[model samples]
Target: MTITRGRFGHYKLLKNTKRLSPHVPDIHVYSESVLTSLLNNLQPLFIRPLLGPELIRIIKSGETYNLVVNDNEPIVTDRKSIVPCLIKQLHPKKTYIIQVNPTISYTPCRTFYTLQRKREGANWKTVHKTVQDTECTPRYMNFLIHWKLNRFLLAVAGKLGDAFVGCHTMVLEIGYAEGAFFLYDTILHERNSKWSQYQSFIRSRTIRPFMPHTDLCTKSTLKAFLRNYGKAIIKPAVGQQGKGIVKITIMPSGDFEVQKRNNLSTYKTFDALFQSIHSLHLSREDYIIQYYIALGIVDGCPFDVRVITQFDEEYGWIATGKLVKVAAPGYFITNRAQKLLAVEEVLSVPDSHIEQVCINGSIALSAQLNNLSIIGFDIGVEEGGKVWVIEANHVPSIAMFHNFGNNEMHTKITQFIGKRRRSLSENRKEEG
Candidate 1:
């Protein structure tokens, strides 16, 4: 079984299907003439790379066109100049695709939902209809019905499933435009979904407020962010165990200080600073740049809280365990820690507040995606007692509890796991 990856591959899969072809917007390989033609025909269109997370949207406004890259502000350009502008901004060798941007009802914001679907025997089911992209709690099926897209989206899912071999699950991104719903994108693999963690959480109302400012790292973005915040952290887009993490700070003497694990390097120029980080991180692959939260200190070391939430068949989502990971001496990341303390022992805020936030946030997250029974949230607290969510782990390790020697919390987590397993067993028995 062969599975195709990348946006262009999926586009081709749908384009060849007579029934699904019309639903997909007209997409073409990037060229000056092709782009110019698209601009003339479509008022608003999108420019996406063949592979990667970069997106460029061009919208017509009055006599000029507005180019919006990712979440940044729009840059105005005339029709004649827009093509050149993109060429200068985008990589020279990488291929890009231009497509007609659908006229969705709502403008792009911090919120969007994923339509989770899974193949059951010979059929595919839309398990999660609305991942709560907006404030109103609309049933996913009902919303699709209102837009008259219930059948269309389902059909798209089935077709894509058949096209992607050995793929039994998918997350569809649906959009409404011109009184019809269209497939905006598809998460065909679990790894792709995991890479979308930052994006998925930022859309949640419960989690967005607590999320620190985060963006993909680049030399320009890194310099601008550091100039504004004076400190920032760079992390691999897909990484674990706190490895490959880098922190940059502007010292009192105005030099740029970079820290990885416990070692520190200082540079006098932004160029030199960027080089250190680029060689250490950026040149290899994508990394996330986030505003550094001055974490609350515990025993002269910064620490962050870890809250584990699990779903109970009878009770919904619950915060089963909470602990603080204090960074070892001379380190900022709490991944490798010297001490593990109870939340109450370290945080000034009431224990209830932390639990409530974790539970509520987890519930909001569960609504966004499917097949979520457990989640571990990394919570950060500043010196001023404010809480921020650093990251949400989909498959949170129970080893932390065992390592901390909190048998009570460890038992609670295992009990929830056991209950979920038993529930699945009974369901399968009934099916059998």
Candidate 2:
């Protein structure tokens, strides 16, 4: 019998549908010597099984380090004693690799900073520099993946690290849930019942003027909002990529104006306009009705700035980059498909002024969000240059920056990650 994919029990369901930030941890390949050193450090270790959640903690006692697993008792042993057991009992007939989970809390020294020595011509010894960028970057440390144990063997590069000197000093959490350790957006989007909770968080940012949203549950709700704003947009309370959105403009002439992805329509009454909207068959109360701020236009196209922010263990909230996205002419939505421009070229106002608002606004919102790794905000400026936050995304695409060909912004962001890793390495040592 043939089984259909994504039908009934065949498909997987997630409690949290939110996307985890695409960050490749700086993990090093494991080896014999590195494993021995890690044991001496008494570092907490995790042994992650393939296709299962990783181990949570590692406890060290003198020469032995205990590997801790979730819902399971800890495995205790030292480097010399555990070595034979690992190679013989664990992986006697197979070969595999392991390393530290960089995002884990117990990494030694906790920094991504490191020293490197590369061979030079004949007798010049080797070249060395701090790893500031991924290009020609050096691994701070390396380890072996214990396949049999299903746990990663982390390389604990000690307090001073690798018997040499290097710089790349700093640590920042690009994005992660705060003290609660879960992303703010994941908690917000996982349930339809969370609407009030998420809205209240936004309100706490003092964003009432920027995002004027009200229930769009009943006909009276729609009519009241129409009468109040004259122009409003209907959107999914939870959505992405500019789908299922409609902007309605109630003209002074008593005609309703509506704009969609493909067509524009006008209706004489709110009932008639909402009837057209009802044809889409979207669930009520699943959407929101919000006043549409007249966006700042460039060359007759509505444009907005998208700002990306991340938390550093050292510096706290940092706006890594910001760029402008302009919708195609007459297109109300801004995605990568449309044209993109530098913020300076689009905003007649000083670029710093705009950036500061984005930076400060993002921080204000992030402060209340636990383990906020990164968030992007869509902000618009009125003709008079007044600021308004259009929307926020937990996982925002960075196509605008790539489309604009801004390497400087890319470099700065990567550097922040590198620094944050370095600082984490240092921070872990202090905690130990």
Q: All candidates: CA RMSD in angstroms?
A: 10.4, 22.4
Which digits, one per residue and each the tens of the lDDT, describe model 1 over residues 1-432? Answer: 354566777777777788787777767788888887777664468788766556788888778889987635689999888977887778888888877756554553211223333223356655433331233323344564554565666677677767764454455656553445566665454432332465556666777788888765766668768889999999876677787889999999999998999999899998788766765566554576898999999989999999999998899998899999999999998998898888878788988888888887777666655668999888899988898888788878878898776489999999999999999899999999
TM-score of 2: 0.50
lDDT of 2 by residue, 167-277 (tens): 111111112211111111111122122233234334444555555455433344566677777777777766777776788887878899888875798999765766666
Looking at candidate 2, what is the lDDT of residue 338?
A: 66
Q: What is the lDDT of residue 323 in candidate 2?
A: 84
Scanning candidate 2 in windows of ten residues, the lowest lDDT window is: 148-157
- For candidate 1, the per-residue lDDT at 20 reads 80
Query: Relative to the true structure, how large is the alpha-carbon lDDT of every model?
Result: 0.73, 0.49
Residue 160 lDDT (model 1): 71
